[model samples]
Target: MKPSSFLSLARFGLKTILFRKTDPILGTIIVTDRCNLKCRHCSVNNITSVLYPYAQIRDEMHKLYDMGVRILFFCGGETFLWRDGDRNLRDLVTEAKDMGFLIVNVVTNGTFPIDLPEADLILLSLDGARERHDLVRGPTFDVIMENVQNATADNICFYMAINRLNKDAVREVCILARETKNVRAVSFNFHTPYPDTRELALSKEEKKACCAVIADMMKEGAPVFNLKSAFPYLIENSFPTPCRQCVVMENGRLSVCGRCIDVPGLCAECGYFFVAEYTLLFRGKPKVVFEMLRTYLKYV
Candidate 1:
């Protein structure tokens, strides 16, 4: 992170700690639910297949900015597929930076060309190694890797969702992140069991084993984005749910945390490591603060 960006995050962290604020400092706006791929673990795609108009997205950005959100993420059902008239995802990213967002990120499956160098972070989904990732996310691993290599920017982060299919390959992903050009780091999240995807959720034992692998990777100096200090919390699922430190906006409706909050039991089963990390940090966990400083300094 740049000095100014780090300072902004520090300011927000201090204010949140001192004032006991529950308001969100980071916000995600789903530009569109229209996706090109139908992964087995995903439940949010292909419902509407409508690209939200540019004007509506702009309005949503302003609304989030008004709500004191400085960090912005543009999510999808594949952000590359999002378009309104002649505007593309890059236009929205530029607009967010102009509107004073400290960090602008885009989360994608990495199936398309990653030419958006304007984005501070391009979170490319890479579930596991070639065969396993292809099994879950379809036969696009080679293409995604090619796109990653072809990408002009160096801000890509490998976002892996560990579940039944890819749990065994977590170490392989760490190696891929280390060897791949333009990939800055790798972040892991357990598969949250939404309504129909319960079978994909890892058991507590499985989650612990995966965390052990990640911990070893961290010790070996792999560019993994997860905090090693919070592994215990993640294994026990003891962290608070429905983290109030972040919010998500889809269409015009805004929900605390991400869209998972609206799902019935998903919040109770949330496996997003960042949610747990942020929740613990807000509650003033000394170890978590140190972990965040170390991981984020390396990431940015």
Candidate 2:
């Protein structure tokens, strides 16, 4: 297997195994509902709540950290769009770091320029190349590229959700990510058919084809983040994941989402690929471990 940080973690996994028995190691915190763009597949436009202040978010982080959460991800409609009177996303990252969190993650839509707040990982939600991407996002690929080009740091990467619209261009996106000036690596995910947004989800056949391409790219040592063994779980939908690591905090409150909490019968339809990836890690899949380590090394 390729040498990676996760290999080192695997060496210490025996020691850390005791911790997983007691508490969640990672969690997602939606610091704000504020967003600048209204992507058709997102629920950001439906949100009518105001952005919460930094103090409240900081308090939430403290509580989670006290609960043994080692990794914190700042997700949002667009986390970079979040702001208080003077503080910004970078401030949030700095605070999370000060609280002794192992890593801080951000998921953004690549609209605004991210100037401050270095994160352990910044997953930029990209659709596809200009023409296809313009259909999902606005005709602002130039601006997005500008932001990405200017965001020439070691703590950021790209995540392109494979959908019917962009499925055919998956390879192109992957190549672009590796060849792009500022992009570090590309992670792939399938679109979730949320309440009002089902059109973006890929078909079973399409997903399989995309996975085949991804697996090939991975075999070729392309810098793409994918769980080697767990990728099949995405194709067949037979993967088992213990989502004990995450407790989503949305709009200043705990929300497990109806899909994960109320009607778990529909959890099989969930689009978060990280779930299967984590399961593969717990299973000690070497390639999966390598992928996870590669991710940490790139971001951390």
Candidate 3:
């Protein structure tokens, strides 16, 4: 809505129109699969189980950058767990920035506290209020809370995954985000049931209910990080869907389709929010365009 954001929208529009073949728009790199906490909703099966070497990580970034990627998100089975020499996640951010990435992002579980990379954003995977959070993610709520508060000086985002256990805590979490200093915004996602975690998946009805609540909160000025077009996908359980080409892993394995999708046929009930967001954007929704621009401007 502001002039600077408007200019950002213009820039995004022009670049998207002109740079069709330059590079992938977003690249998610997982540094490791070893996690400290065995979350009930996560399947630890068939992970690479090793930290990717620092050299390989550098080379991979170069490859993605040469292809024209401007955004890279550092993902992990616990990215903070990954280590190479004295290098850590923060180092990855510094290096990625040097490589000319427009912005770098990190997603972490918040178990092991460490200084983060100078990334444009850091998304802490928070599920709910303390009790519910502890139930779903183990007794690490205090730790995550402490770390999140400590990391406020940096631009950081909180990602809350709504499930049956944490559904009641939505309002509280929203208030927490709003009241807390150094908290940029909060994004809500429904639980995506990977093989060993199907029970954590919310029912279709529950998903609708949560989406309605979130929509109401947005109208009241509660800061939520969801595109306007993508909002409906969360609400109605029906909308345009995107085909994810592939997600490359640290071990050089490309988990294209079957790998990312939970095995034994639970993909239908899966709730990865980005699928819908990307779908609506690629479908050319005007609101999605504006939301993307707003996010980019927040960083630029």
The deviation in Å at residue 266 for candidate 2 is 3.4
The better-scoring model by TM-score among 1 and 3 is 1
- In candidate 2, the residue pairs with backbone N, CA or C atoms under 3 Å apart (3 or more residues apart, or in different chains) clash, namely 90-117
> What local distance difference test score does each model get?
0.92, 0.71, 0.70
- Clashing residue pairs found in predicted model 1: none
Q: How far in Å is the alpha carbon of 98 misplaced in model 1?
A: 0.8
lDDT: the better of candidates 2 and 3: 2
| Residue runs of model 1 more than 4 Å from their true location after superposition | none
* lDDT by residue (tens digit), candidate 1, 182-252: 99999999999998899999999999999999989978878998888888888888998878989999999
Task: List ranges where model 2 is wrong by over 4 Å.
Answer: 1-22, 44-46, 255-264, 283-287
| N/CA/C clash count, model 1 | 0
Which tens-of-lDDT digit does each residue in 1-300 have in candidate 3? Answer: 346535543565456545532224566777888787776667752265788898888888887676555567888788888788898888989999878777688988887764763777788887777888888789999988788777635566778888778887777777777776667778877876775667777777787778777777778877777765676666565654323422444565544322464365455554666666655555567788678666556533
Worst window of 10 by summed lDDT in candidate 1: 260-269
Off by over 4 Å in 3: 1-23, 240-247, 255-267, 295-300
TM accuracy, model 3: 0.86
Clashes of each: 0, 1, 0
Task: For candidate 3, give the lDDT of residue 67.
Answer: 53
Best candidate, lDDT-wise?
Answer: 1
